[model samples]
Target chain A: MVRLRLHLVAGIVLAFAVRGPAFAADFTVPPVPTHYVTDNAGALSSATQTSVDAELKAYEKATGHQVIVWIGDTTGAVPLETWTGDTAHQWHVGRRGKDDGAILFLFMHDHKVRIEVGYGLEGSLTDADSSRIIRDDIVPRMKANDPNGAVSSGVAAMLTTITPSYAGVTPPPAAENVAPPIVSGAVISMFGLFGVFMLFIAFVIVMRIIGSIRYGYLVMRKGAPAAKKEMKGFAFWDSSGGGSSSSGGSDFSSSSDDDFSSGGGDFGGGGASGSW
Target chain B: MQQRSWIGPVAVIGIVVVIALFVGSAYNSLVTLGQAVDAQWGQVENVYQRRADLIPNLVATVKGAANFESSTYEAVAKARASVGQISPAVVQNAVNNPQDFAKYAAAQDQLGSALSRLLAVVENYPQLKATENFQTLQAQLEGTENRIAFERRKYNDVAQAFNTRRDTIPTVFFAGLFGSKFNEKPYFKAQAGAEQAPAVNFSP
Candidate 1:
């Protein structure tokens, strides 16, 4: 019975260890949906989706702001704020340096709505604005079973709040505070390790040269020592190998002129979340 | 042995060239990774400062509620003061100093809990919650909290990258050659008692 209990304990420990990656793998970050809106939960009508897409596209073209509306079933176990932040970042929903992007995430099943504003837009589209939009515009309509009205007006309020003339948030010619998301950051570090390994090899070579010179000196003086020359090559292996995995390249294949593509924006989690 | 006379000099020169190349590349890469950590640390500080800036306004707004619980807002004010009490020098050099980093993180976490407690207390006063000013502050506080979490996570990522490169084999051996240049940056551990929600005590 004790042996059985020990085996069960070991099994539970093993299960826990395996769970970390499994949980991460479950919520795969999907690519930015086309036309600036993806209603996977079928919440928005086709007509509303088309008009909203056109309005968002026009808004982006006029002001250089990218606003996307993504309606999904749920965010699963992840908190609403975290889910939207991660998704907005992965989608790169705004301009590269300006980071003037916003995403309105509506999880129908979870009954949560969040407006994830990019760093550049944080000044104009403040968290208070986002919260008010959700509280006044989105949550009411959502509670009334009108996802269409909720999304359209919520996005409208966001656009109005962030309009350059109205909000007085002019897109700065250059954003000094916002840093571009460091792509290939981990990959560069991997190269650093490889460089160190080369350095180690060079160190070994230097030692060998020193030894050969000393051996030659001994031979000239003592007229030949033992022929048994020991060559101990030190193998330095990384115990924490593969610890820094490179963030995989996000495929941006949809480059058609009319297609809505992310302009490589960064988010600092300046947004608000609400539930009906 | 007479024919091999040229070999020693050639081998020495060859090894010298290799050493020079490796040293140049290794040192450059270490510098690059270190700068990334420093830049990320700046971002973490920026977000924390943003949160701290919001606290005074938040406290002022909450103080308006008639007969509101003074203890909760006072606790938040005290926590914010402690967060500010941490010396700028220590904050600037925290990446290198694990103890300072821990203290900084603990103080910020204390402030975070205090703020959350204040928010929880606001639930009792519907009048305060309805007011546009109070609502705006609540939203800002929530957003700032999220930003703190986001920036902290990014800081940890860069710090981990630096630590991994500095401590991994081969790199580990060479990292010491540059004295104190590549110090292992400390990571922000998950907040203590984060999983448990703040316990709100109700007085009859």
Candidate 2:
């Protein structure tokens, strides 16, 4: 009887031990779907998925860059960024050679979100940008226990920054800040001449006023101190020539015409992860 | 018999000496490659150590601001301690002992999983993520992780070279005789979950 009990116990332990690796082998990162929106965690509502799916599909169709939304449970027991990065790399969403893929990852159970930027999109979807989008747009929704809300708003925020141009933002011409017609050197030079002419007119007006005030002080009236006060006001216009045009920011909203696509892009493991 | 036939004896001696020299050169080459594999392992360990070292600072920095779950921090601490359990002696012999190598690799993998979980937990704490110290630590940890990945790849390459040399005809026979530890070294293969090649669509 004692030998039989020992054998039974040993058999049970052996069975469990054999099953352990078998169970471990079953756990895998979810495969990527053909669509841009993959909601394996069931965190997203079908309605939300439909809308997001359409939007993402249309965007990808218009521009080759791939932007995917993935919602899984707890990053499947792995580090969120690494897992998301690995997924993004595997999906190869962006254009093949350009490596412009990005994954908007949401670990629903973990309440974490990451934007795994590909090599091509690193300049546009920067770490700072991703972090800001997560902190500002995604975290609040996740905090409220709304994963879909978080993803939608977060995707919107990202789209707002997407210039339809390339990933990295470029500085505009100084002439653009000055005025719209300064694309050519001739136009820029003409604007410069116009600014000089405006300065000349103001200078002439100041001289006339000073001449009349001096005349009044010497021959017509005696208000030299008061006229001197008027001259101080004229000094304010001196610095105005080079200031107003640059300060107005008329073309501030102008963004790039560049669009993002995988272009066969790859990822060097760039992205940020956050939990709510 | 004192027959003055030195040519036969001299020729035999010279041939024996030449063969010894050839075997000596091959053995020396194997020794050098083995050392190289060891050095690569050192690099791999060094990167892992850097990552382990950064965790305390990461945990401390995260602790100050975030109201993150305590279990995550505990898990990281536990994993870290386990990783530290491997001694330098074991590392030196890990190449020769598959069991030791597996234990060491398992420990590092656990630490990686724990650290990643810690970072994932940190995601929910926006305030913590915003802090300068937390950001710096996060960057360092990520950087170290990448270095570890890169170094592990290099380690495997050198290990492959070393093992092949050891397995080559005469070296295989003489490896145990020299006792220079020129055995096969283990590759740093992350145990399941991390083993899957991530999904990708690559446009040419």
Candidate 3:
């Protein structure tokens, strides 16, 4: 009986010893990769790009998570503009220049649906605007597990909102044809109208100069004697009137000259003697 | 002589039984307390996860309201990123390493501050405040905070019991031998300046 009791106690102790470590080792929630794409977008403007980059960096610091963002026109093998229509594209585009488009993509590693917005469409459609639409119309649906529907709705809304901004700027014609708008005819017409107006003004000024010269010559030839008589009569009358007004007239003339000289730098010089 | 022999045998058996019962009860209680602690940890983790999950929507909503305030938006984004960056292994290490726990605490504090700033800014936006999704997320976050407080309390209770057992006189002897003494865990104490929820400040 003594041996049997001892064995039972030993067995119980051994059983507990075996289970204790295992129970202690078991932990909840297996470790997962926490890296997430915070923002991914098409070619963004410099200002928008700077803001997005700063936002992502701040996000990473605040969250202690790795945020992988692709800020450019292309996704992997396909252009961002095309990637929106199809998912098979893998080409990731980086910021190049004014012509190169960019996109902003935000991907949470654990989350199924990622957010992608076109930063290239800033003034036309802002980050805030796109985010609002997504959060309002798409994110709720996505959280409810309808990713396909959410994406479709988001894409449609974005396209509808953005298309009007590029009313005349046509889409890429073909693989090799990616030229911007020409607008040469409009520019030519604008310049042409300005040139014609300048020439018309010049013609009028020349005609007036010729007419003035001809009138001066005609007056000298046809009215010389009459003008001489009138001048003599006017001189006689001026001399009679000048005796009492000489001092005041001299003061007024001097002051007027002074004012003219002082104001003569740009405007007065052109008008002073000409008006007289 | 016959009576004395029976007394000796009976005395030995009683002593053995009493010793066995004492050790068994102690071991069983320790195990049960440990399990409770583990279960409470799960609840804490769940609430934390729910908080984390609420972040993107909150951020998105705030982003919509105040797009020009890049600094505030950046703060929110950084907090969200930090939450995402913290790996589970790092969280596990936090249980052992005080420094790791500090980092964890700091990250959580940043997120809380960012959320406060976000909510404060949301006051300027009546349209955003009226959004159904934003309202839902806000409600969920509030609920999650309450749940977190409850879970933290439960965890502390279990931890207190475990620590008491490991510190008491005779049980401390076994705890020391087995190296099962309770480690101190930092609680989510509210920051000094953090008062009422910022969401309450929304006028509309």
Best-performing candidate as measured by DockQ: 1
- Report the C-alpha lDDT of model 1 over A1-276, residue by residue, as the tens digit: 574454455445533442321212235787666668888999999999988888887777667778889889888876666567777777778877778889998888988788899999999999889988888898889888999999888988998898735332333333343445765777668779778689889987876676666567656666563322321232233122224221222334335666677877888888888888
Off by over 4 Å in 1: A1-26, A164-254, B1-4, B192-204
Give the CAPRI class of candidate 1: incorrect
lDDT of 3 by residue, B1-204 (tens): 767878988999999999889877887777777677667676666667777887777767667674546687678778878877888887754644557767877887688777667667666777777877776566555444444444454455565565555445444445434442344334445464432222121222
Please report how far candidate 2 places residue A188 from its true position, in Å.
63
Assess candidate 2 and give its TM-score to the true structure: 0.42
RMSD of 1: 15.4
Which docking band does candidate 3 fall into?
Answer: incorrect
What docking grade applies to model 2? incorrect
lDDT score, residue A33, model 3?
Answer: 13
Over A87-194, each residue of candidate 3 has an lDDT whose tens digit, in order, gives: 201111211121112222422232322233222333344334444555555567646655434444554454445444322223322333233555667776887977
In terms of TM-score, which candidate is strongest?
1
lDDT of 1 at A248: 25
Residue A119 in candidate 2 has what lDDT? Answer: 70
Worst 10 residues of 1 chain B by lDDT: B195-204
